[model samples]
Target chain A: MSPTREEIAKLASSPAHEARLLCRHNLVDTTSGLAGDYVQANLVILPSAYADDFRMLCARNPVPCPILGATPVGNPKRIIPDACISSDKDDFDIRTDFPCYHVFSTIESDGKKKVIIEKKTNLLNDWTDDHIGFLIGCSFSFEQALSQRGLRLCHQEDNKVVAMYQTKIPLLPAGIFHGSGFVVSMRTFQPEEVELVRDITRPYLAAHGEPVAWGWDGAQSIGVEDINKVNYGDAQTIREGEIPVFWGCGVTPQFAVEKALERDAIKGTVMSHQPGRMLVTDWKIVDFLKYTQEQLGLSR
Target chain B: MSPTREEIAKLASSPAHEARLLCRHNLVDTTSGLAGDYVQANLVILPSAYADDFRMLCARNPVPCPILGATPVGNPKRIIPDACISSDKDDFDIRTDFPCYHVFSTIESDGKKKVIIEKKTNLLNDWTDDHIGFLIGCSFSFEQALSQRGLRLCHQEDNKVVAMYQTKIPLLPAGIFHGSGFVVSMRTFQPEEVELVRDITRPYLAAHGEPVAWGWDGAQSIGVEDINKVNYGDAQTIREGEIPVFWGCGVTPQFAVEKALERDAIKGTVMSHQPGRMLVTDWKIVDFLKYTQEQLGLSR
Candidate 1:
């Protein structure tokens, strides 16, 4: 069954530590929706052979594909365990906690494994030791951050997906993976409130927060008319005399994965979140500082 | 004539604000080559009738149309002056600072107006009490910031112009003006340095900073492949393995202005930085708090 909003909101507002337990105890179906205060990451399950290229792509394009963590070859229990997930997939019983898992059978063709994973899947026994897991940052972190200011997400109001679009913008290609920049969902407000909203979200870009773009200044998508007509989610309402603002979204990884479809083998059984919910963890948003890599002694 | 790089860069890094003083004195054709430390801004000389809508557009899209400062109706100087040139566009001299001005007699029609005069001409005659001048942020700030980081701007390195592309991403239509997202020049980097580049740049998006987008991500009208085939500047050696990183560029306003061309309007001429260096101000990069009107307690 599809998830409900209240259930998702409840899960999102819950404490991160508790949220992890829900996923760990097999009480949730892919903590896609439960943690509102935290970041939701897209997961990619690949073989160790493809790991290096994927890692470089993340390094090359961190925004659309930030590396939250990844399991070591043959070990599913930890991926930057000190900072990322508390434990490995098996430890949390992820197979059940996630609403479902998509099982992929890599068919080798030519020198490369021809990736033919489609929308159809059942819990097959193909999951194995060769499987490597990767967690990518979600665009929802910005949405959750924005929600703290009492702004209403259109999806919350309409029970629809966030409006997303396919843009002419291309994603940085990594080994076997290429992504296209998609349409950013836009929210409109009265002309007077443009700066108000831009100001509210500036802190998240950097501790040195600055508004990237605003109004016509920041609204660098296709024109609003085309954007409104083409949407991945329901369009939001704009009061008379209001302008629209857009932000870089988290769905970027999805784009990244799609771009790689022809070349790379992608087997991601994305964990689902409760409606309005995401996985809230003990992770502090600021702790993911670029400067702290040395402190953490982690190699990129 | 357009400004040269060595001349522009020298003027920019110079301790003397003479380039501005020359423009202020109605001494130069345009201030394009005069200073480098500060940001160059586009001057929108609008009548009151078009002011509100234009303001809304700028506020909605801050990056493409950043509003650095604006004057009260009939006032030539704004409270916060454009940091690129001297604050005194009205009193100092607009006629000569720019190589030439594209006068739109009626901002609504994008109608052309006859050139009133040139450098050494009295702008006091054209600067009427009914006119309001608005200064919008230009790209020079980021360009200079990038050059300072040792990243060779392709245009300067290859002695070519920075390439621009029109994108499927469109701007929100505001009143009579319409525009699309920009296709900016790309810079290739070693895959690893992307984060460092983005971080050092965080403070400049607003007064503080903004996030950087990777060019290789599709649909943004830029990518590593496009780096070679269609660039504004002469393509440089990306070094066998550098990944190209892209940023939301100032050139966005150039496209916005171009699309708004179908109508007669209060348009700011494209003030392409002729190697236009910004007028570095007393503002230290660190003190940049990314303040908004609300944060400053000035907004109602």
Candidate 2:
């Protein structure tokens, strides 16, 4: 069930620590519209053996797989504070922070490898010392930025998921992780406002930056077969004179991981956040940008 | 001795593939002024045991350690092409291509640990499968950009090494790598031209971005106690009305590795490119920026 506008506003204004408690206790079903000013990150946890290759994959495809930071080998506790959502909370555990998780694995049946997914509320039981948790930048950060600029998001207004599609755009292959293309989230903007939207969103490079494609031709260029049907998330209303705009999605790595598992490239379980549900962080979008610019040498 | 002006111009116009050949055959002692239109990189090699930690350290302090790309584990050949200087050459060997290298190690003497640096022309004998080669962005890329904008570099004109100093600015520590600050490369510009220089260099985020500090007070703020006495490279002439402008140097990781060795953080030999000698590559600075923008989500 979607929250009332008043409730949404209340959630948006809540401190990150309080919002985390709600999610940690399973009181919140989804992180959307919650802690609106705070940075929300997509979470991916991988075993130590595959960590380096995964890091390289993220490096290779930074738009879809922008890395916020990761845990050290065998350590579930995040030592680096800036990359983390909660800078002041030393006890923030990746295993129990997010609202939900999707665990992916592969099994052999009739001499064919098949992928399987299991959903969970937390990761306390599934985690191990060999696992490293990585936080990836989410479009929610830019969505918030866009919202502040008076650009209305139809999905948010109607209480639906941001439409996502698996495009034919091939990702740069990394070790044991290949054969997956980009997964882009779709939004709609009028033709006249498209350039303005691009200008506003381009600064959030860590949050997937500007739109990759827009308009009917843009959608076709990326090879989106059906506009109404989405691979993940729910489709939103498309007003007349408005065109669908696509931004690189965080679900990209998840799809890549699934592909790797199907190819038997990953030997162990891979965990990721359920779409739309994220780990709300203490960092604001502007502050995170400053952190990246000063510490990571990435400036607008 | 430095090359003559005609020789410098000829070297600058030479193709990256030819420049690499010159270095590979030991025909060139330094990469400076060679393949001026191409990208040059600083190399760092570490055992797999320490690569992840070192990678994290680089991530934590990116201005001083911007990663262009890295060789896969146990692979001496750089598989990633776009990050390579010779993007068209698949056989860009890390062990043999660089003009010079500095091998860092530790030894215990009189009950105290001491760090030692050894100079080598190649890594044929020292390299093993356990090593991972990382290509870090060098200041040379941005220096070329500055030169193109009519901002003359004193060191380049006089054929002197860019003066570098160890600064007191602390770096964020990672596993088994800590206790080191930043190393900055200094150039001089007139007081009125400092802002213009900053505007020019800011776009080269991979090449240490804009100046971290400028002017006499800027140098003092970063803890350059004696500007004339440089810690590495030659000190160039500081003309009247010109102020020292500092950018994060590639030597930073070298200093960090030395500090780690002193603290017994690293167990095996570490390798890096010698100051002033770089690995020339096929990528031009403008094209490299576009690659980062498209692939790495870093746009100017």
Candidate 3:
């Protein structure tokens, strides 16, 4: 059964408790709207061999892959003070934090390597000593920030997943991770509200920050062929006087992995949390904004 | 002979003429005071074979090696409209534009690779089709902004080169670019005036933006020991009521190259403009600020 808003708000208030419930009992299938005050992260796990290249990919394409933190090789436990809940718990395991994980393996088939995706509840059995994990910033924190400012999100109102599309924007190639196009998530807003939405979300640099582009025809500029059909997630209808705003999506790294597998640049497995089943962290939204402000030299 | 402030101011008012004077005629060796309004760049030239790795290094270490523009492989000319001066003239060549160039070669000695620096007028005879040029943003633009805001720079007032030091802060490693320490340029200011200087210079992100550290203890935080000595340039005295402020220096890439050569990551030659001698580009200081503001989503 779907939890009520009050239940979600209670969970949001105590992220550590919520994480225990989700990780231990598998109480939630999707992390959306739960722990709204804290930062939720997208997960990407790979063998240590590809860690350097992946790091380069994240550094080069920061907008799409703003890394909150990364675990050292072979370390399943992440300990970032005030940034992650896992740091507080001794038994915190990345392999089972999320409700579901999508394990992708690069297999040689028909003279070419192909990536095959398999859904798993947890990676406890699949975890290896050579694996490294990366926790990337997600749009959830910024969405909560928007809601706090009274901005209406169409996806939440409609009870559907946010619309995601793969755009023609070429990501800056780094190392063996190249040639994959950029991906973006769309949120439609009234024409008059677009600027305000941008202003509110601009400070969350770790959470993909501000909208990359906005307008009725914004998707076309980034090479989105049709709004009705999305590469991932559900598509929302554009009402009268509504414009679609696009922000760099966390799903970008997954696409890059697929592209890398195709090019034989990556030969091992790549795993990630299922869409919307993010790793809820202990970090407050304000912390990220403060860090971004300081890094940009906006704060004294 | 060092040009006087009046002569440099006259040249600063006309960058195209100044560039011609510097390129065609044997003019001033240091480009510090010339072209105050325009952006000055530090030049790094390398073979196309190392272009990808070098680009990755710059992207990974943006504050230390903020790239303004890069020429295509084998292209001696850089034509970035309104971003660089080389675009304005057909004869503008990266090989001869600067007053002096430091050509570095990686040579094997005692079974270890060592980098040797040689000063030259131009790479006209050494220029090859396989070489690529990178024009990096220098702190000159932000220094001008600080001056415009009535901030007094100790190095400028004393007519000494900006004091530079190699900090223990290790740069984020990219492919073939690891273990190199970060480098910073220092300027001393009165304790009360430091905040104003940071506020004025923070907008120029293309140039090294803001002071990374300040005060006598600032250097130690980033891993530099002893303020009395420096790695490069002239040392300035920290006054009784003043504190030292350090910003990321352009010399970082050269240090990285040396490190890479030591590790045998780079087997080819690396060339750069001599310290204080820079490429005076056509881009205005305001343009860089606007670009930075836009990139950070600070503007509409």
Candidate 4:
């Protein structure tokens, strides 16, 4: 039997492990509202040979691809002993903890490369001992903080996936992960409320920090031709006088993988969380922000 | 011919290209005083196979291994056309531009790995098409900014190389570059002047911004047993009431290379700039700081 609305709402405030269990059982379709206080991550898994280059790509373009933590080679368990974060002791499994995963594979025949993407309920069949997983910071990790400060996210109000778009801004190329552009998540805020929103989001550095651009002019500057259409997720209502603010999105690596496959740069399988469905990690947002601040030497 | 003191002083304020030419001729022993307004870089060159791991290692340890820029595979000419920083148009050659280079090769026989470090005037003899060079930011980039505010550095005052130490602080390892610890450069400051000194250096994010540790207790915490005995550079006098302040050093990568070789992780040669002898690039320090601020989304 399917869970009722009341049952799902109760799961929204549940602990991270409970939410993860829901995902493991394939009972949760989207992790956006579940475990609202815990950290949510975008998953990207690749062969160990390609892991270093992907890590560098994320490092070079930190705004678009902030890494919360990475799993050791052949290890799917989410445990970072020295991170001092809440997630260090969780009985987590990367392959089965997410509701859905997208797998991409490339085939080279007669000097031509073709990419095939397939959807799966879990990654158990595709995972290998030579693979490494990266948990990239997701914008959803900061949504709770915004709501606590009286800011209403358009997607949550409408019960839709956050709107994501591919932009003209190019990421710094690293190794074979080259020729990719930036991807951003969009939200509409009143002109007067934009500054307060920026102030609140600036502290969540791991969650893409402040908006990279805002206003109608801002959207055009990043080369988003149509605000009504998005590359991923659902579009939200843009009320009159409400400008769209764009923050770097974690979907960037997915786009990067596609671009790399198009250029024949990758020859193996790549896996990622389906957009809007994230891995509910044991980390608390506050702890992640504090850890990031200390790493950047911004802490007192 | 050896240049006079007055000529060397004049060369300090000269353009970056002129200073690079001096180093190209092996006329300058060290790049500390030359090109005061320009950026100086620590060089690390390795085979293409090891490039990704090294780059990821640097990314994971940003405080100790901030990358200024990287050269395209097999390209020794320093030209980053789209980097908007001052270095794009200069005729800079990485192999012959530094005063000296250190060549490290590993020999494996009978299941034993032996690392040999050799000194050379240039890298032309050993460099091949498979080599990719990385230019890392050096602390010297911020010394001018500190001096501009009337804060004198101890090493400069004594006309000695900055003291560097291998610390007990382990680095976040990546791929083959595992089991390495941090390396820090030391300087002494009066107790009251440390805060102001930190504020001046903090803005140079790419140049290993701010002190990682300070004072005598801070020294012991990082496992620096004796401040007077140095590992890579000369030690300066620590006056009474003054304490030693430590900054993340670029030498960490070299130490990382040593540790990796010791573990039988690397089987080929590694090339690096001789300590205190850096690559004087076309990039101005001011431009690099501004670019870094914009990238971090901290620019207004």
What TM-score fits each model?
0.45, 0.53, 0.54, 0.54
Off by over 4 Å in 1: A1-300, B1-16, B25-34, B81-100, B105-127, B143-145, B157-169, B183-202, B207-251, B264-300
Off by over 4 Å in 4: A1-300, B1-14, B81-90, B107-112
Better of 2 and 3 by TM-score: 3
lDDT by residue for model 3 (B15-34), tens: 65465456434476666767
First chain TM-score in every candidate? 0.65, 0.90, 0.90, 0.90
| Candidate 2 residue lDDT tens string, A93-116 | 778778788988777988878988
Task: Give DockQ per model, in order.
Answer: 0.03, 0.03, 0.02, 0.02
Q: How close is chain B to the truth by TM-score, in each candidate?
A: 0.62, 0.90, 0.90, 0.90
The TM-score that candidate 1 achieves is: 0.45
Q: What interface RMSD does every candidate have?
A: 18.2, 17.0, 17.5, 17.5
lDDT of 3: 0.73
> Which candidate should be chosen as best, given lDDT against the real structure?
4
On DockQ, the stronger of 1 and 3 is 1
Candidates' C-alpha lDDT:
0.47, 0.76, 0.73, 0.77
Reproduced native contacts, each prediction: 0.00, 0.04, 0.00, 0.00
**Poorest stretch of ten by lDDT in candidate 1 chain B:** B270-279
Candidate 3: regions farther than 4 A off: A3-300, B1-17, B80-83
Ranking by lDDT: 4, 2, 3, 1
Error of 3 at A277 (Å): 8.1
